[model samples]
Target: MSENLFVKWTILPQEPPQPLLYCKRCGGTRNFRSSGKIRVNANGKRVDAWLVYKCMSCDGTWNRPVLERQSVRSIDPLLLASLCANDAKLADRLAFDVEGLRRWAPHLKEASNAVVARELLSETPARPLELRILCVVPCHMALRLDRLLADELRIPRSRIHALEKSGALVVFPSASRALRKPVRDGTKLLIRPPAEDADWIARSAAYGDDCP
Candidate 1:
């Protein structure tokens, strides 16, 4: 491989997955979004905590239990304090917990849309260089790797497949077909575009730019 140009792409899912639940007010199954709040109740030696969710249709509320009737002594002090304070980070993490939400309902609706923030590591080289991208994902997302690349690069998924087949684009952990899989944290992609196409791909990977 020649000298490489690097870019870090952080993929953040726009919203947490919504669990479809029977809404009493709506009289039907409705999607619930996180209210970004925590509800805590203290009853003598026991404590209860829930991450609050609200119905998208009618604003009906649901308390997704974080913990139920657990002794305060068993709880970590920092966690308990953060829950009491309704810490934004903690709430966000809870909201993205699709597995946790599954305990209450099996049906889930997830937003595949994401915000991709890219930071270019080096200037364009005199010669075409290997374009390396590190995918930094903070939470769960429904978007596929191929879909993301196609959208960001303004190229069709078929183009990506062609590149992979011709050995121009290399995705890490060759054991799996990650191109079609959900975008994951810490996945690395290396693009060795032919000299003719290298410059355009580098620019597109770093920002939203139309190639000449």
Candidate 2:
């Protein structure tokens, strides 16, 4: 069995606060910030103070304290839309077994393009890891490579592919010659980690550039 089959893990921060504004033009909730000043009137007297902001969402203006401006944040409606949109897009892309592909094909294409762009920007460029493993027949049946790794092992596809490419994976075939071929439906394979590649794997998992 190859060590690559064993899952690698990592932690992420908790959820962030939602943005408050929505873009009127696109109906997106993500509003980019614009600078201005607050105007106030009290008891027939006019006062100009505080920093004003223009919503990326609707181009609306609002006032807030200048001194504490760093604490302010806004939710992006576009981001929320993308999240909901991506879910539907993923379902469509993986729906090869079912009908209605035509109806969702356009969305699937758009989503895929967006995802690739995001991944290119977001994913750290790293070499693959390797793992070794042994297993019984029939255990690998009826599963997509990504699905199986994510479900049974709780690892991600990107990591798995990286490990595979780097020769960190060693699959011990079952007694049957048929089991020796590339993993297919209903085959059981054991996954193990290559001791030598541990350091490389750790380095590959490091963080990359910040989002724009």
Candidate 3:
């Protein structure tokens, strides 16, 4: 049996989704920006919370509900305090919550286009390297797997296509158009490098280093 090596890579998408809403003050649809403020209200034993957003053009305020009426005692005091204090980190994280934003604004635009950070998480050494790629998307975005690999591996796109054609690279849940498709989490790629490039590929796999 051929030796099997394993390497794990993680891809993190870095960008926040923007809310597209109709600004009453502006009299047209415009993007809204996160105000980093949480509005909280308490009535008897119940509490309500909302994430505040403001129209970019007119600064009109819109409240995105974070929580409906609920028992105050059931909520974490620290989280409640963070909401009252307008925690920047919490607000920033919520800015990426596209699903939440969609409830308030039917059409939301992304503040920035998706960019990725590639990280080599782990590797088990052996003769042939089977790479496991985990893609963590904070928002709804699409990027081709081939381009990502080409850039991360410092290899040419044609080389990747050629390898796939020759059976040197095998994608799990294999799709004929896998390379062109958007990458999803838990995708596995098994690579059996050709004899000519085995040593170079092995070195790259061992170090998880991009070509210089």
Q: What local distance difference test score does each model get?
A: 0.87, 0.32, 0.70
User: Cα RMSD to native, each candidate?
Assistant: 2.9, 17.6, 4.1
Model 2, C-alpha of 174: deviation from truth (Å): 11
* Candidate 1 lDDT by residue in tens digits, 1-212: 34678889998888889999999988898999999999999999999999999999999998999989999999999999999999999999998887788898788887799888888777656565788889998877789999999988778899999998898899985646879998888889999888887777877887755333
- Candidate 2 local Cα displacement, residue 144, angstroms: 2.0
Candidate 1 stretches with Cα past 4 Å from truth are: 119-124, 175-177, 207-212
Ranking by lDDT: 1, 3, 2
TM-score of candidate 3 against the unseen true structure: 0.70
- Tell me each candidate's TM-score: 0.84, 0.23, 0.70
lDDT of 2 at 181: 35
What candidate 3 gets wrong by more than 4 Å, as runs, is 1-5, 56-59, 110-130, 136-140, 156-159, 193-212
User: Across residues 167-206, which tens digit of lDDT does each residue of candidate 2 receive?
Assistant: 4433333333332233443333333335554434333322
The per-residue C-alpha lDDT of model 2 at residue 198 equals: 45
TM-score, structure 2 vs. true: 0.23
- Give a tens-digit lDDT track for model 3, residues 1-212: 43455555555545566678888887888888888888889889998988888898889988888878989999999888888788988887777787778887878765433355555555444454444445554455455778766765557889989989998877777887998887766677777777667656655544545433
